[model samples]
Target: MSAIGGPCDRALWYGFRWASPKRFDAATLKRFADGHQTEAVAIARLKACDQLEVYDLSPDTGRQFGFEDHHGHFRGHMDGVILGLLQAPKTWHVLEIKAVSDAKFRELEKAVEKVGEKLALREWSETYYAQAVLYMDYADLDRHYCVVCTPGCRRWMAVRTERDKPEAGRLRGRAQTIIASDSPPPRISEAPDYYQCRWCDHAPVCHQGEQALSHCRTCLHSTPVEGGEWHCARWARKISVEEQREGCPAHLYIPGLVPGEQVDAGPDWVEYRLPDGSVWRDGGAAYTIGDTIEAEAYRHAA
Candidate 1:
């Protein structure tokens, strides 16, 4: 309804923009488009590891995956394997090569899991399995891997399986509801918690960003009492009217994605700057102490 352009809508834009290689190419300068260079580096890394052989899983191989404009409707292409498509005996793994960092690893892991599932459902489950064991219905394979490589750090991690019986049931139920009523998912009695809230594309409906305060693991308001204590209850005070009146920096300022903008994270902070405006988040409230508070005050100042 908001034309998908608002501080709240930035997350939606960020979700689709970076994941598409085409978007990345257009947004970055020619010199910065080091995808090919990274690919060569990753290929060499895989070759040296001797753990897996690589192949490209493009449509030229007679397999269709990834976003597809099906009939008149736009579906997704799920099968463009980014890096080494490997197989060991009966094991199949789709290894994505990324400039590995703690944040990069998390991002890549989510991307692989999300896109792999789409490919598995749209294309042949068996074919997807031969490349990567997609967690469509079960986790039968021992290893579902992605390789993340930075200039200095190369890291690899297996996809952990989740026995999400309730979630699977809900998805199935939603499909049935759509078929029967020609509508979207039904409104439920209870809303999901904020930790799970980030993954929900429709989270804006509930003021989830503010709702997220309750789930913050570290809040200064928390009482530290003992050698070992669960402080969540003490810290769990809901946002008050006075705090709202005071204009919490988090509420007023959110760096939503512009169509062509870049976000970078540094050792101590994350920055988002567009042609119009910029935002910088302090490392954390947990670390700020004494006169260092003045620095944070200035940083959050508009």
Candidate 2:
């Protein structure tokens, strides 16, 4: 399969709500690796104690649980499952670990005190709640033990969450929607300057009409070969699934890959006519598909 299993909060959240092509910069990648290391350290400390029976799923061959649908296009993986805890009854529970900054931890602490851990988590981040629910459902567990720790602070909190079947079903349906459909879900907002959109890595591509599909697997320049191999038309080279997911700057959306009517085209740029009759320009340096640019500017540029 071209798509790898998504079990983390970020992947699941993006898959279900916004399946934009992810572009992880070096800083983001380093942050992820550091967070994983922090989690490993915390888990190791927990494993050394007698209060809990922790299972490590960080190893490549470790025991993990996952589910696939839509011909393995939609999938999820759990970090690990635990059976013992000092405060809880002896029953299986999903063990989820997260390392947050001290500032975030303080905010979480206040939220936990105000509304309780379960509700606080949902308020703090919907992605975390959705990930927990998916893990519970796929791992056949009814409870979740989410461990949150701060770097350099030995203190940590274990928050318990129960399975929410209704939410899980909704998320599952969303995942299926992404896998079965050609286009990604609508952008969170039409305005390029939207706060969320600004922070998102996919902002450049998601807002641009340069490519019909931002991902390599769906790009026009790429063709899937046997044995899950992909050949790039532009480079005439083989591409791996990992490389496809982390798209390059050279990504060009195939024409008609996006669900829209083409209204204009140039030697390097293509414009899709929007519902409001404004042209969405693709393949330009300053103008992108979803970005709000002046009509006169688009006309002059086109």
Candidate 3:
């Protein structure tokens, strides 16, 4: 659900397929840590508010309020459930906390003041707004409240969004469709310099980087099945997470993911002619592919 709201369909597909391992640097790691601490501070402050009751954890299960679909393959977790806001004391609002830069905070305030919370929220960040709606639908709530703060917790603002069942339903269908797809979806941009693609993690393979981590999720034989399970047709069994990470000798890459054009194929192998005039083969085959350094390196490492 967190990724469902992203701009690129292909990026989301790549993520679901485990096309790339997510790697974050030290600065990014620190920022994530700081964000969590800020959320905690903000939650504590919210708890101090006399006008609202914050259920940070689900009273029903004594855990975070979480919901899922497609047999738990698609899931979402809320920041909390908010009750007793003075604006609508009887209504329950799904709570979402966000930490943004000070500049962004000011811009958000202006947008909210100009067009109101719901519209401002949709414009502020489609990702967050999309997530909020799904959260509302799963939680069986109609309203969502957002508490926005700065990194240092020096400034605060709130925005509220109403549930759109039709929109949420569409998003849910989108998620299910992507989850069931045997191949990746279309790219959002063709250019490497496109703003959304610039910092994307999948850029390497998506744009020409040859190496993709070998895993069941990236293999041709694996398919996402009903009941939140992954099945490997090659082995004729359910694939555990460990098995997915450590693919077998019979593993084959999804042809589309490779940079070359498919020139020959058979039950055992699919061959390609890479741009450098070298042949590459994914599985055991009689035809020889010359100089598959990348493939050799990956398979060797795997």
Q: TM-score for each prediction?
A: 0.31, 0.67, 0.90
lDDT of 2 by residue, 1-302 (tens): 11222323233334432345556899878877878888888778778877667776645565555565555556566667776676665888888788887887887788889888667766666777888887787777898888888863366887888888998888777666654443444666788788876776555556654332356665556654554366666556777777677544445555535546887776446778765667667656654433534523323331
Answer with 2 or 3, whichever has the higher lDDT. Answer: 3
lDDT of 3 by residue, 147-207 (tens): 9999857888898899989989988988988898887788898999998888899998898
TM-score attained by model 2:
0.67
Clash pairs detected, candidate 3: none
Ranking the candidates on lDDT from highest down gives 3, 2, 1
After superposition on all CA atoms, what RMSD does each candidate show versus the true structure?
Answer: 20.2, 9.6, 4.6
TM-score, cand. 1 vs. native: 0.31
lDDT at residue 32 of model 1 (Cα atoms) = 47
How well does candidate 3 score on lDDT at residue 123?
77
- Best model per TM-score: 3
Backbone-clash count (model 1): 9
Off by over 4 Å in 3: 285-302
Model 3: worst 10 consecutive residues (lDDT sum): 286-295
